[model samples]
Each structure stands twice: as structure tokens, then as C-alpha cells.
Target chain A: MHKSLRSTLWILIATLGATAISIIAISRGESINALWFIIAALCVYSIAYRFYAAWIAATVLAVDSTRATPAERFDNGRDFVPTHKWIVFGHHFAAIAGPGPLVGPTLAAQFGYLPGTLWILFGAVLGGCVQDMVTLFLSTRRDAKSLGQMARDELGAIGGTAALIATFSIMIILIAVLGLVVVNAMKHSPWATFTVSATIPIAMLVGIYMRYLRPGQVLEASALGVVLLLMSVVGGRYIDEHDNLRLLFDHEGLTLAWSIMAYGFAAAILPVWLLLAPRDYLSTYMKIGTITLLAVAIILLQPNIKMPAITQFIDGSGPIFGGKLFPFVFITIACGAISGFHSLIASGTTPKLLSNERDICMIGYGGMLLESFVAIMAMIAATVLEPGVYFAINSSAGAVGSNALDAVTKISAWGYPVTVEQMENLAKQMGETTLFARTGGAPSLAVGMASIFGKAFGDGLLAIWYHFAIMFEAIFILTTLDAGTRVGRFMLQDMLGNIWPKMGETSWTPSVILTSSIVVAGWGYFLYIGVIDPNGGVNILWPLFGIANQMLAAIALCVATGILVKSNKLKHAWITAAPLTWLAIITTTAAWQKIASPDIKIGFFSAATDLADKLASGTLPAAKAAIAPQLIFNLQLDAWLTLTFVILLWIIILDMLRVCWRCVTGKPILPLTESAYKPSSLLDDWVRD
Target chain B: MIIKLKTLWKIIRQLSGDDAYEVYLKNFAKHHCNHNNTDCSTPLSKADFFKRWQDEKWQGIKRCC
Candidate 1:
């Protein structure tokens, strides 16, 4: 039997075995034993990674083994990063894997542990891993072209232009939604807010020391930064206890939004040698170390997965952001399981660092599989909480019933009942006024983790455990925030430079500041609205983010399909084309549903109409009426975003058709100019020996 | 029709290698069509023309060719 065929069969058996066991356990009303399930999952994943992943890495990927990495051939101290294959793999994995895997899966567990887990596992193997690997391979072959450029090259000029537009728009929406999640988590927690807020100065101090005093001492600087960051977390407890300090840090949501904007501007304007580089380095370390520790902790603790498989909230009315399990779970767990944004990174940054083509499997496919496991851990963390507490923490007051008393009543009416007394007791235990409407998945997951860690470490360490969880999430989220801001700033400057050449230069301080402010304000506006939203921003912003991210994936896949067809690998094109078609269908249907549905809670168009009706009937209160215009505008914006995605997808499809026609008829297609860098003869062996 | 499809597929596979397939297609088109006009003598070129073809007010032949 062929080795590839045999290995593929084993992977199927393992995956099916895991799936069958999980289904039977859930159906039989047996408690999900975390240790057993995790072991089983890891065993299966390891086999897949070792046998199947390696085979694909060697053959299907067909990496040119003879070529020497850039580090060996064109080693530059700066951007031309040269490192060992394993080190590069580690760095890439650490950079991409963040709190996304942890937070998304935990929240999506509202559907059922089985559904969320299966999606993470299956989605990673088929959709996410394939997207990442193929994008990396394509980009590497094209001299590390970006996702947008690849789309244009394979699809044609029109597809490429549309992809760029989609990318820019998606970046804005992603930053805004993520910013909202952070603000909501920190809103009422002065200790968390202060500690996280302190990281800025800590990063700057480390940044200065690295730049001026100890240049090239990344390891040393990061070590100092991590220690200081932990100290700041400890220090936050004292600040929270102090009345004056607490008052100073405890600003309202809108005020916090402004502060974040100011921080983004400052961070962007500073030289990379300063805060940005040091913070990125420290964040890189913290993200990797903390996620590993949490995973280990979960494995060692082996806590029971207590939450029911399916919640009563499956009717698009569940608390922590509305929408049923079928679509929303797929959307909520977007980045961790499969994200279009990763395609951007795969093409933009990682591909540029590829030393060997074979490494693509490890960095792309293996990295995504690791992220999926993180999501699985997040699911475990979320499900461990008592159902009543989970409901109280995740449910918005408006949706859970309306008002506290009503919320309690309605929740008690459900199978997993919670009394007012029970709610108060749980809130007191968790040290919060009302756990209701803490829409950000981070806080609830933190609280649950704290309980687990508290039990393991000792009762007295609960506070430390809580802050540790906060610091872990903050490190990842802040990394994303700053990195996103810098990327956005650069993009804006590039666009502006096209109009006024001087504005494009990175060294121009005035232009840098102007572009930075514009970029910050773009995402900041959305963050501000999300913060002020009484209905919990997750309800509105998450779906938008999900759709946008998915659309980017569709674009990426379209580009890949076009390239395959152009290369006359039509038989194999379906490997990418199939996923592309499915994503298009999913995104289009979701967008259409979002636009057409009359429910103000689900559909943007219907929501707009509902608001207008309320205004005309004079039934809305003055305060509600004031916010009505904003809601209506938001609805229209949603529609516009949907339209943009549709147009981008179609443009790419048209480009693919053109490319296919060209190839089929043996027409001359213009190829881009070649790069100067040459691959070693060793690397050429696999491709052309 | 089947033969044509098979021939087209073969041409596509050959084109995947290099631009030599373009010359072959051009010759094949000239033999079949019996036209001296460069624009009409080649199916491959016709395909390129149509792919790049735009229906707009500012369309320019120089910009394309």
C-alpha cells in the first residue's frame, strides 16, 4: 500500500474515533472527562501531524529540498531574518497563536462542547490548515507576495484590487471589534485596567533600554519586561485597595476609549527601535509562555466539562452575543480555528522567512492545529462553570429576560434554573457587582480559570490566579492591538503617499503622526460606539467581524484556485477551490440573512426598519430615540459591508475565470519580474533536480 | 466536441510549461481560419484580447497591447 494512502487512512480513523467517542459520551449523559478526552485528542493529533502532515509536507507540498534558507544565503541582521528551521517554526507559531484560540472556543461552548470541539478539530484540519499552508507556499513561490497581490496575480487586476479593498476594510472592523472586547473586560475592574494600562510604560522603558543601552539584547530586555509586568500585576491589587489610585484609573468606558486612542497614536509614532519592538518581543514571549502554562494547567487539573452539550439559547437568543449554534459558532471561533487574516500573515510575513519549503507544513498546518487545541482548552474552561453562573455571566439583561428580577425569573424557568439568591451568591464569590452582560469572553473565562487555579494552587492564591489570567489575555490582546495599529498606520501612509509622495515616507515624523491618528480614529470610532452600546457591543460587532474575516479567507482561496488553474493543475485545483466555494456560500447566506431578516436583534435591515417604526409611532423614549439614528446608521453600514464583500468575491471569481480561459487556450499571460535572490542548488533538487 | 475538449486540455497542460504553447496555438488557429489578419489569425491572441477587453468610455488599444 502507498504510504500516503495508508497515512491518510490512519488520520481518518483517528479523527472518526475521537468524534465517535465524544458523541457517545455526550449522548449517554456521561460527564466529559477532560484528561481522557484531551489525551485522546492529542494522541490522534500527534499521529496526524507526524505521519499525514509529514507526508503532505514532503510530497504534496513538494518543497525544494536543495534550496538554502535566506539566512544562510542572504543573511541580513534586520528584516532578512535568518534562523534555524525549528526556531523559525517556533517563532511563527508563537506569533500567530494567541488568546483567540482560548477565548473564542470557550464562548462558543454555549452551543455544546461536542459541536464546538468538533468544529475546531475538523475546521483546523480541512479549512484552516489548508488555507495557511497553501497561502504560504504560493506566497513563497511568488517572492512572498501579499494575499491581495496573489489574488490579483492569479485572479487578475480586478480581483487583486478588490482583495486590497476587502483587506483594508476588514482590518478596520477587526481592530474595532477586538478593541471593544478589551474595553468591556476592563470597564469595571480597576485592578485589571490599571495593571494593563501600566504595560505601556513598562514596554517603553524596556524599549529605551534595548535601543540606547543594550542594543540586540532581545532575550535580556524581554526577561526584564516579563518580571516587571508580573510585578505590575501584583501591584494592581494594592492600587485597587487604595481609594485615590482606584479613582484615578477607574474612568468610564468613553474615557477609556479616548485613552486607548491616545496610546495607539503614541505607540505608532515611536520608532520601532523603541516601544514597538520591545513590546512585540515581550508580547511574543508572554503569549507563548502563558498559553503553554494554561494548557499544561488544564491537562494536569483535568477538570470535568460540566456545561450541557446544548443550551436552551440555541434559538438565536443566547446571551453572550445572539445567533444560533449552526452559524454563530463557526463565526465566533473564526481566528482560532480558521481565519482569513492568517492568510495575510502567511503570505506577508511568514513566507518571507521560509528557509525551506518543507517547513511550510510545520509552520502553516501544524501551527493552525496547535491553535485549534487552544480553542479546545478554552471550551473546557468555559464548560467547567456552573450552568447558572455561565448564564448570569454571559447573558445580557435585555435578552436574559429584562431587568435583574426578570432575568432571574426567566433563567429559573429554564432547565438550568438560577434564583436571585444564587445569582448574588455567585457574584459575591466572583467579586463582581453583576456578572450580567460581561460580553467579552475573556473575563468569564478568567473567572473560571481562577476558580480552577485557586483550587489547585491554594485558596489564598485566588486573587493572584485571577490577575494572572487577566495578564495572560491582556498580553495577547495588546500585542494584536499594537501590531494592528502599526500595520494600519503603514497602510494609511502608503495610500496617502500615492496622493502626496512626501506623506509615504516612514521617517517623516509629521506624516507618521497624522497617519497614525487617522488610523487610530478609524477603529477608535467603532470601539467608542461599542463601549456606549447598552445592549452589549458583542451582539452587533462580533457577527460583522466574523463575516469580514471569512470574506478575506474566501478572497485568499479564490487567489489560490486561480493560480492552480493557471498552472494547469486543474485536477488538484479543487483542493483549494472547494473550500473557496463553500466559504462564499456561507458568507453570502449569512450576509443575506443579516440584511433581510426583520428581527432588530439579528438582521441589520430589519433592525433599521424597527427603529424607524418606533420613532414614527412616538413609542420610543427620548434616550432611546437619541440612539435610534446611530442604530439605523449602523444597520446601513452593515448592509454596505455585506455589499463590499459580495463585490470582492465576485471580482475574484471573474478573475479566476479569465485566468482559466487564458491557460486553457494557451494564451500568453504576463508574469511579474523575478526577484534577485537565488535559491541554493540543494533547494532546487525537489523542484527540478 | 470530445476531441476538441481533449485537445484544449492538452494545450492547457503544455501552456503550463512555457510560452512555446502560445506559438503552437497561433499556428493552429491560422491553419484552421485561413485569415491573414493578425488579430483574427490566432485563437490564443483572441482569448487574450477578450480577457483584456473592456467596455468603457476610456478604453485604449495602446494601453492593452
Candidate 2:
């Protein structure tokens, strides 16, 4: 009784503190400090982890610490190791932490910081963390089934196929959007282009060292790679100082787009030991190191949030991306909050490494909490910039204007005053030709990161810091681009193998090249149009990516809820059902809006129609007219894609609901047997460091 | 203090997969001794181990966006 009372008191205190900080964050103060965002997020995460997640593990799932997991049962000593919880946590976090959280929050900051901040907190605690933890628990219970297998077993064929197709489509859209981000960051900027290009040779050298020079020496090769990467950052400045070398490295969007597509194709077909493995190591290390550095710098520096609590863009005229703050903010910041993609990681290799079933709460729920915190830091970084400058960097030329002065005038007229001189000085400070209309969130994030690092460390190396940030983001984004392409190739081959056995052989050169090109071309077409789109392709692609990602989350939740209802624990089914319901509402509404909204800025079909009319009437300029037909086709294609996603989403949700109804009404359903799950365990013995 | 730092480094190596081959060898030998079995087949070489590890690791949906 005494222990229970004390725990209750602790929970009460945590709740009260979190509420106060959140209120302060929500209220419009003169200028809120960035530290408040950090504090609020920490308070909410701890409270959720302690009370909510622990309850779910104990009561909802009754996770048995003594129950031997697949890792312990199988004991392969290779892929299935019964690892400690902290090690598992690190691996899981690294797997899920990508450009999604950083770029999503930065783009959503256009609606001001509050909407994104609240969603990142609320969405992760109630939705994202729950989905990850439950999916991890379910997968662990079933000898570590992948998500598609779980869906197929629990919900039937329609749900399984929908889940698989959603995962594949989102992978394509995710890579195309991320590729656009890298292109925008590297285009027309000699320093950034030089630094990013240096990573290829750097990765290849590390690959050769790992493969032949000193086999199994990952740590040493990665350390050497880090040194070379930093040297290239410094060397980029040298190249930038030399006009001819700078010109050679500098290229426009079209050139970078083709280069990235070719790189993806090469990575997909090349042996994993050569390029992908070495690149993954370097990116994982850099991602962890840079995120840690950013967190510490933000704490030490404590920059003030310069944007308002809510901006006029809340009503839907945001410069960065279109659509109202209602469904769009939720869509724009998908990963940092309740990303559907985390479900994939939760159900993937992470589950197969679990030693104790009870560790699922920490490795899954707690891991997602940390990822959400990274999103909070990204939000702080973006909002800490001057609002006018943020708009100037992220807005498209089609939205703002063709030149720096006009962009500044237009942004200033919206009540956030900026000048051409200020932007020019910032560009020079960052070693760039221009900063206006970078438009894909990478350049602005680099600037924000540079400013923070410059203030916290020293102001002397702002230009180098800027390029370092760019290089880091590009490295993370490019690794995802290639790894995703390779995975998509395997997925396509698997699907096609069902039809033609010859096509299924992953080692055949003909099969490899065919699938690799098809996968590359799948995303490359989107990347190509995104490169040439004058209205800023991210404006369309990011939302589509968000919708598709959320659809996957919905499918994962359906499977979890179906299992809950089938296990006769219908009372606890709301834990997954609530998030599934919310995702369904958001994805369905967002898809409908993208398809049918009358506003040309928000809807794909409307944009296509608007452009087609302009083309017919000869109102478009010669340059716009030349690209008008392709843009129209692309927009209509996006609309059709969104419609398909909506249909697939409903089919999965309704099918799962049908399965649950059958179980509820005593009808026969797919039986989950005791051989798949057994209960035994105590939790106290497993917390050792 | 030195021991503690060593332990921390070991943990980092474990998590980053820097020490994967070492762990695999230890586990392989231990499993060979399990159940009084006397198979005594050679474990994979360092080069082959790394190659197989990469092939298996990338075969599934590993990374996220």
C-alpha cells in the first residue's frame, strides 16, 4: 500500500509538471525559449513511459520476462542474439531515426511551432509509441514475424496485400522526396556540392578498406572515414575559393537529379560489401554523433524561438507547403510524431534480437519517444531562425518571386520583415550563391543547424559549419535513398517471382539489372519531375509521402487490434484501435483533399487542370509552357496514386474490422495458437546495464 | 575507472556491430560445446563472415525514412 501510494504521488507530480510546461508552451508568450519545448517533451515522454507504457506491458500484453524470445530460443549466434535491452534500444533507434523526423518538423514549422509541437508530443505518446510497442510485442509473441506476415495471419489476404503494397509505395515516395531534399541542398552551391560529392569516394575507400585492406575492422575504417569527411568539408571551402574547381562541382537540379538516380541504380546492382554496407556504417555513426551534438548545443545555447506561437499560415497559406493546418500539419510532421514507418522497424530485425519479452516496452515505446524528441529539437532549430528568413529559404519562386529582393519584399509584406542585404550576408556567411527558394527544407535546416553550432561552439567557422550540416543531412538522406532502392528491388523481385520463378533469382545478372532499373525508374520518374517542377515538387511529394506512410501505420494498427480482439482482451483493444481510427480519419481526409479539393494549391487534379487551361490559352510563359504538359501529367498521376492509397487504406481497415466483428460475434476466425506465445517471467532481473 | 571505460567501449562496439565477428565466434564455439555435440566444423572466415552478414542484413526492410 505504501509503495502504491508513493508511486501514485510521483505520477501526480509528473503529470502536474508536464501540464504546466505544456500550458506555457501553448500560451502565446512574448517569446518562448527553446528550452521549454525540450522540457515539455521530456516531461510528457517520461510520464507516458512510466505510467502508460508500463501499464500496457503489464496489463494489456502481460509481457513475460522469463519467456524465452526467438533470439534466445533459436540462438543462431548471428542474426538472433539475445541482447541486452540498452543495446537493442540503440539499434532500434538508429534504424528508425532518419531524415523523416528532422525534415518533417522543419517543414511543419511554417504553420508556426505550436501545432507541430503539440502533435509531436500528443501523437507520439498516444499513437506512435503505442503502435511501435504493440507491434513489437505482437511480433515477439509470434516468433518474430514481419508485419506483412502478421497481417496475413490475423486479418486475411486483402489486409496482407494492402499492407505490402502500402509499404512499397511509401518507400518509393519517401525516396523521391528525400532525393529532392538532397538535390535542393546541393544545387547551384559549389561548397555543398563539393562536400556531398566527396562522400562517394570516401565511402568507397572505406568499403575497400573493410573488404580487403583490413577485414572486419569496421570501427577503424569508420573513424578514418570520419576524418576524411571532415577534411572534405574543409577542402570544399578551398574549392569554393578557386572559381574553376567550384564551377566544375557546381551543377543545377537536373544534373544532380540524374546523378542521384544513377547512383541509386548502381547501389542497387552493386554488391552490398562494396557501397551500401560502408555507407550505412558511416551514416549511422554520423546520424548518432550529429544528433547528440545538436541536442547538447541546443541545451547550452538555449536560443529563443523567433516565430510566433501561431502564424497566419495556420489557416492554410503557408509558404513552405500548402494546405490548412488541420490535416496537413499532421501529414507534414508524420515521422517526428506518429510515423507509420516506425511500425516497419518495430516489426523488423529489432524484434528478432529481443532477449526478454518485457524489454519490448523500452526498445519499442521508449525508442520512439527518443525519436519524437529529435523531432522536437528539429522544430526548435527551424523556429529559432528569423521567421522572414525561414520563409525566404523554404518558399518556392513560384510562391514568392524570381529574385532575392522580390522574395524579401513579399515575405516582409506578410509582416515578417526581411531584406535583400540580410539574406545576402547570410548567403555569404554560409558560402552559398543564394539562399532564396532552396525549397526542400535541407538548406534552411543546414542554416539553422549552422547558426546553433556557431553560437554554441564558435562563430568563426559558420561557412564550414553550414556545409558540415549539409553534408551530414545529405549523407543520411542518400543512404536512405540507396538502401530503400535496394529493398524495393528485392520486394519487386519477390512479387514478380510469384509469377515467374526465373525472375526471383536475386543473383542472376539479368534479373538484378532488370529489377534494379525498374525500381530506380519507379522513384526516378518522380525525382525527375520533382527536379523540374517550378512550383516546388516537395509541395506535392511530401504530402503524398505523409499520406502513404500514415496508411502503413493504419494497417499495422489493424493487425494489432485484430489480435487484441481475438485474444479475448477486447477491453484493451482501444490502445491500438484509437490510433488506427485517428490514422484512418487523417489519411482518408488528406487523400480526399489531395484528389478532389477545388483549390489549385492544395489538390493535384486542380493543379493539373489549372495548368492545362493555361497551356491551352497560351497564357503561360515559354519556359512554363514547355514543361506544362509533363507537369499536368505528373499531377494527374499523383491524384490517381492518392486515390489508390485511399482505397487500399479503407480496404485494409474495413477488412480488419470485419475480422474483429466475426471474433466478437462468435464466428470462426484465424486462430492464433499457444505454440506461438507462452507466458512466464519476472521483470526485476532484466534491468542490468 | 579504466575498466569502466573499457566496458562502455565494449558496449558501443557491440551496438555498432564493430565486434560482431568476435561475438559470433564466441557464440559459435559455445554452441559447438552445447549438448555434448562433437561436430567441430570450422566457423566462417572473417572475410566470408562479413560478406554473409551483409547479405543477410540487407535482405529485409532494415532502414526507415
Q: Judge the docking of candidate 2 as incorrect, acceptable, medium or high.
A: medium
Off by over 4 Å in 2: A1-16, A19-26, A677-689, B33-39
Candidate with best TM-score: 2
Q: Report the lDDT tens digits of candidate 1 across residue range A131-181.
A: 888888777777767777776666667877877777777777777877776
Chain B TM-score against the true chain B, each candidate? 0.26, 0.77
Instruction: Tell me what TM-score chain A of model 1 achieves.
Output: 0.92
Clashing pairs in 2: A66-A681
What value does DockQ give for candidate 2?
Answer: 0.56
lDDT score, candidate 1, position A370:
79
Q: Please, what are the lDDT tens digits per residue for candidate 2 over residues B12-61?
A: 89887888898778878877632222545877788877877667777787
lDDT per residue for candidate 2 within A1-689, as digits (tens), equals: 69999898777768766775766566675777788788788878888898899999999999887687877766666788778888999999999999999999999999888889999999999999999999998888877888998898888888889989999999999999999999999899888888888999899999999889988788899999999999999999999999799889889899999999999999999888788888888899889999999999999999999988888998778877889988999999999788888888888588778888878999999999999999999998899999999999999998998888888999999999999999999999999989999988888888999999999999999999999999999998999999999999998888989999999998888989999999899899999999999878999999999999999898899999999999999999999999888898888888888999998989899999999999999999999999999999999999999999999999988898899899999999989732455444323433245
